[model samples]
Target: MNIGIIGGGAIGLLCASYLSQHHDITVLTRRKEQAEEIRTSGLKRTVKGETFRASVKARAGITGVFDLLIVTVKYHHLQEVLDGLSTLPRQRILFLQNGMAHLLDLENWDTSHSIYIGVVEHGAMKVSDHAVNHTGIGVIKWGAFHPEDTAAVRNALNETPAQFQMIYTDEWKKVLEEKLLVNVCINPLTALLHVKNGELIANPAYEYMMKCAFEEALSILGLAEKERLWSHVVSICKKTAANQSSMLQDIVKGRETERKAIVGYLLKKAQAQEITAPHLTFFNRSLEVLEKKQTKSFE
Candidate 1:
């Protein structure tokens, strides 16, 4: 299978390296230098203290058609990527963006293309343009966005390395919502306080704030099993104690965070539902301030 992976970020490099083992992989990057570097040095992935390299075709922009196009770009870049995709021939696309905001854009997507939504559970960091560090090994759960055949792509992806797992499910929306809930609980607080995930649960005050955010998000999402969901969020914090949340990383690097996609989406939903979400509103406003500060500092 010829698999085209858009976005040369951490997740993109990680997928290209692992999936290249079983399939022909082509990585579409935003910069010509990065694409040239990848083509010259190959895609490098380090996992569990061991490093591996896989040769993959690299290009600066979208080119040939692919059997499967897995988009690993951030939510903020989805619109730009979709605009580019519109010119290409129809193909199966699987979106691996973090927040649910991209779903709104997909509603008006070209119906001729087969669309799929997925949540990536793996933790990865880009070491360089052509290299990535696989911090945590986890499965990617995905489902067809609309009724369509997925057996070929599913079977092809599942045959890869054991550590890189692909799971197919019919309830992809629930998976996304649960992931969003976890993000809402941890990301904003961690980003604002500049703390690691463990500190959120380790500090009493921080833990209380996280709970407040969790309760608000749970209500806004209208998800049942409050206790169970809260426990899951806490467990994630414990599991990734030493690691920084993606939001925190964005803050530290002075890059734009996904506050709009995750928190902003919830805030809008809260408004539509007429549910008061003070904590969420506070987080959103605080993050906006921090983002502005970072931008000014960079300037």
Candidate 2:
């Protein structure tokens, strides 16, 4: 399969490095310098204590048709990417954005394209423009957004490398919701408090605050199995106890966090459902303040 990965972020580099081994990979980046660097140096990936390089085609803008286009850009940049995709020939697209907010945009997408939604469970950090560290190895779970033939997606799933496994699920929406729940519980709190994931469960007051966010999110999402879901969130905190969340990293690096996509989505849903979500609302506003502060500092 000839795969074109959009965005040169951590996830993008990670996918390009692993998938290039089996497929022809072309990474479309936002900056010419980054693209040139990738083309010149190839892609460097570090897993555990070992590092390896994979060759891939790199360019600044989208060109040519691809058998599959995997979009790994953050949600905020998705609209621009979608606008660019409108000019291209129709092809299968798999979105790997973090939050469910992108689903609203996809509702009006062209039906000629087969759309798929996925969540990347792997933990990756961009070491540089052309390098990434695989902090945690996990599978990618995805499913068709609408009723369509999934043979191509299934084939890609099966052909992936073992360490970079992919799973085809019928309940992709559920998978997304569960992942959102975990993010809701851990991300904002960790960012606000400047604490690692374990501290949320380790400190009683922080754990209570996390539960408040979790309960509000579960209510807004109207998901059942409260106890099970709560347990899953706690388990994630324990599993990645030492690591800082992507949200925290964004905060520390003075980049905009995914507040609008994750927490803001829930707040909108809460408004439509007439649910009181004080914790979610607080997290959203607090994150906005921090984002503004970071922006001002950079200026």
Candidate 3:
């Protein structure tokens, strides 16, 4: 299987590294330095028992067809990424990003773009130039986001290092709603407060804010009532209370956070429903302030 990974960040690099052992892996990046680093030293991974390296071809651009094109970029860059990939005929485009906001636009992107809405719960981070730390255990949820995925996707997924837990059903709306609940509750507050997943447990301040974001998002999920939505949010937060979310990690790096993708997406959905969620708006606003502060510091 020729697997081409877009976005040389944690997910892109890690997926390419693991899949390379079983398949031909190609990593696409904009940075020449990362390309040189990967070509010289291969991809380095640090996990529980062992740390090893694998040779994955790193490239600065795309020029050929690939069997699997993993769309691993952050949600905010989906448009630009899709535009670049427009020439790559028919391929399996698995979206491993977070949040529900971007889903609305997916149907419009290329009606034939076999979309697989993948929610990766894996905790991975770049420890160095070509090294990544796999911090936690999580599986990839496949066939839930888009039903267009064929048997080939299943075959390719089974071939990869990551286990694919297939939700074989036409009712993927429920799955996306569950994912949206997690993103709204965890991503924003964690980034805003500079806290890890466990911190949301210690601080009632974040918990309260998370509760608000959840209520707003749940309502948007079209689950019927606002209170029912809030209940789902509360239960899930307590479940994954230890890991550091990707959005929070982005904030710590002083880089652009995925607030627009997470919170901003929810707000847009709520607006379409003609509903006002003050809490979602509040978190979105709070993130704006924090983003502005971080941007100024960088400037």
Over 35-78, each residue of candidate 3 has an lDDT whose tens digit, in order, gives 88888999998777579799988877654677877878888888
* Cα lDDT tens digits for candidate 1, 12-46: 99999999989999999999999999999998899
Taking all chains together, each candidate's TM-score versus the true structure is 0.97, 0.97, 0.87
TM-score of 3: 0.87
Model 2, span 6-27: residue lDDT tens? 9999999999999998999999
Clashing pairs in 3: none
Worst 10 residues of 1 by lDDT: 290-299
Error of 3 at 265 (Å): 0.8
Indicate the TM-score of model 1: 0.97
lDDT assessment of candidate 2: 0.92
